[model samples]
Target: MSRTDFATIDWRGRPVRIECQWIDPERGAGTPLIVFLHEGLGSVAMWKDFPARVCEAAGARGLVFSRPAYGRSTPRAEDEIWDVDFMHRQAHEVLPALFTALKLGDEKPWLFGHSDGGSISLLYAARFPDKVEGLVVLAPHIFVEDKTVANIEIARTAYRTTDLPQKLGRYHDSADSAFWGWNRIWLHPPFRDWNIEAELGTIRCPVLAVQGIDDEYGTLAQIRDIAPRVAGICELLEIPECGHSPHRDQPDRVIVATASFITNNRRQTP
Candidate 1:
């Protein structure tokens, strides 16, 4: 069984809690560590057993954590509003603080991130080039698209008219906080211009960018555009008949591909 813990720290000058878990705790420290980052509306619970299964397959240590306002972690303040730089702040500030609090300074971790989480991982790897061993991103958005906005608008309607909130509540401490915080920001007019393509140039580690062929939230260009900027560092995985969440939709394939990618790269890490 995995061990669950909480890290209480000050972020943005206020106390916040991050819920984290260690998968395959029996694995030795010498094994590479894979940190799992959830999507915009995802929490620790949202990942289910995928992290553990991946770690087992890869023979790696796994760290799965919920960001401040998701899962069993802290709730967003009533007046708090997420800005365009929310993902950047998560990459630059909150994550580093969590690392420090958890005593994870000894080794560089391989990041597996999905959607917004993938974008944050990209930003983090770009900002601290040598700190990550490699990364696997699923449905990451490098630039906003008309289709992205259109789908998100539909999601907003689903939240209002359907049981989306009730469904999400099972995974979040405050479903409203988790939903609105992510939804409102993405739907904001200014966010349409949000792009991180230029930042991809600085990433020094290997990258495996995956997306479902029929992803509702983004297009193939999300990962396709990454290759030109990052050059030799980027690889693409387009899963057939898959949707936004690859791990959920294509677990066996994701597990095998991610494990193979890490194993192949780790042997070359020197």
Candidate 2:
């Protein structure tokens, strides 16, 4: 594995910086590139080394980047309340722009998105199936759940008055940007009307959706709702004793399952 470097990526006329890292395998592995999209509060640093491990396991190149207001990326202003379609913007605008900036269309990368990032990945697959080789999503939210909203309130309180702001600030350049953008929409009554179930039906690639049985934010319906509509090409993996963050809670299973999914389709990358 070679060392990773930081690169400033141009996105939507703004300087939405990103960290792009890749390793050309010594063994000449046939796997397609794997692109990792981060969680709502996640950045390139928050992903830790999971992407590297997955790339190593599946013998693939990896691309990881922070979204607009997280990690080392540029921070949003103090008053940007994210709309319900915020994730859609991330999917349709930011990700594609980043890929275009990097000239990655020719590589046909596979997507690995978690939490909010997973939802973005699903939207991307639906929007650009030809460019996506496959998808591996963890704890993706296709619709809002009662528990999900409940947790958001709890998070709101903690972030507003508690040490959560401080804790999150360490990871995000603008913790307020990350926290408030995700918070207001979640607690908004209108946002409850969100349901990507229709958008997901447009996906035409093989998808591996994983969630923890003990997930605190979403339910099985999150993935199951999309599973039936996706041409029966979706695989649902529910892990026991795991919570919302499957990559952190069950890295071994995540690595194994992701490796299997990526390799299973490696030969079809024509």
Candidate 3:
């Protein structure tokens, strides 16, 4: 496991500390760099060994980070309320600042994102076409779905009635901040219309979108819709007997597919 470090960046006019780690940092510059973006409730710790395993298999180095409000990074203010554009802010604002702080200037890294992270990856790629190499997204959401809202409602209930808070506490500094930051915005009434299909049309890099056949939060359409919108090569993988979190539900298959996608795409890139 790599040692976690903090990168301080100015966000919304204030300095925010982001927790990050580098996997296989000893690898030469010739090796591709894969940036792993965690899901809504995920953090650097939640990724476990998946990033390292993927980096090893694909002959790449990896970067894993915990977005603000999650993990040991800057926690959300007690009264902070994330709006519908929060993910957009993360992609367009926070990510770029972190890269600048880390001096990753001009290095077009491949992105591996899950769920909300996947959406952010797409937005970043769309907004900065020349700054990304490729993308591998798992259970990405291009638009809100009825099933997604329903599950989020269920999650809200579970957070209060079950041990979900305790489980999330293992990864976040303040479980309430992480939970409410993601939950409230997701369930916010206007968020139902949140969509990014048009933004995807601007992406010029290859994309490999994977989704589980049995995902409770969303259907295969989440990935299926991506194929037609992306301007570049878009591949879809539907894994059977999996759920929202494909990496957790079926790590071996997810790892193999992701590694193969990264390796093949790297070879094809000029």
Q: TM-score of model 1 relative to the true fold?
A: 0.97
lDDT per residue for candidate 1 within 95-181, as digits (tens), equals 888989998875799999999999999999999888889999999999999988898899999999999999999999899999999
The C-alpha TM-scores of every prediction are 0.97, 0.92, 0.97
lDDT of 2: 0.83
Clash-forming residue pairs, model 3: none
Measured with C-alpha atoms, the lDDT of residue 37 in candidate 2 is: 88
**Tens digit of lDDT per residue, candidate 2, span 36-123?**
8888778887888888889889888787878887877777766566788899998888887888877655667789999999999999
* lDDT on C-alpha atoms for all candidate structures: 0.92, 0.83, 0.92
List ranges where model 2 is wrong by over 4 Å. Answer: 2-13, 23-30, 268-270
Q: lDDT by residue for model 3 over 69-167, one digit each (tens)?
A: 999999998778999899999999999999999999878899999999999999999999999999999999899999999999999999999999999
Q: Which portions of model 3 show Cα errors greater than 4 Å?
A: 267-270
Candidate that beats the other on lDDT, 2 or 3, i.e. the better one: 3
